[model samples]
Target: MNLNLRNAIIDNVSGNSQDQLEDTIVDAIQNGEEKMLPGLGVLFEVIWQHSSEQDKHEMLQLLEGGLKKQ
Candidate 1:
């Protein structure tokens, strides 16, 4: 069966407040379940798409720092 994970993730979190969204992200990361990665990717994609150039640069810098530690 074909599935649209991006839309599904968005639908599941629809109408969530900022705190709720933060909780969802924190929970997913803390859980570290492989299943959660796609949802997180979708969320990150939304953030990336809407971010300003400077925001994107900072995000990339953070991501680079994160990868260096791994």
Candidate 2:
């Protein structure tokens, strides 16, 4: 079987408003289902691609802090 998961995810989430996107992310995290991970990753990819260097740095810092909390 051939599957294009990334494109599928992008297509699914395309045109979503900020609030709807937030709801999708929050729901996925709160649900904590492994199936939702790829979707989250796709979202992160979109964010990373569009983020400026400073935004990326801030995200890295936040990610580092979250990792430390683990």
Candidate 3:
């Protein structure tokens, strides 16, 4: 079967408000379900595509710090 998962996810969440989007993300992360990853990745892709260099740098720094907490 052929399915456009990225577009599907985007379509699903396209009209959400900021608070709804935040709740979606928080719920996905807190649930820790692998099935939710693609949606999260799509969300990140949107964020990355729209972000400035400084914003990307700050996000990378935060990601690096989070990853080092093992």
In model 1, pairs of residues that clash are none
TM-scores for all predictions:
0.92, 0.96, 0.95
Highest TM-score: which candidate? Answer: 2
Cα lDDT tens digits for candidate 3, 1-70? 8999999999999999999999999999999999999999999999999999999999999999999996
Q: Which stretches of candidate 3 lie over 4 Å from their true place?
A: none
Q: What would the TM-score be for candidate 2 when compared with the true structure?
A: 0.96
Q: Which RMSD values do the candidates have, in order?
A: 1.0, 0.7, 0.8
Backbone clashes in candidate 1 total 0
Candidate 1 per-residue lDDT, tens place, 1-70, comes to 8988889999999899999999999999999999999999999999999999999999999999999999
Ten residues in a row with the worst lDDT in model 3?
61-70
The window of 10 residues in a row where model 1 has the poorest summed lDDT is 1-10
Every candidate's lDDT: 0.96, 0.97, 0.98
lDDT (0-100) at residue 26 of candidate 3? Answer: 100
lDDT of 3 at 22: 99
Residue 62 of model 3 has an lDDT of 98
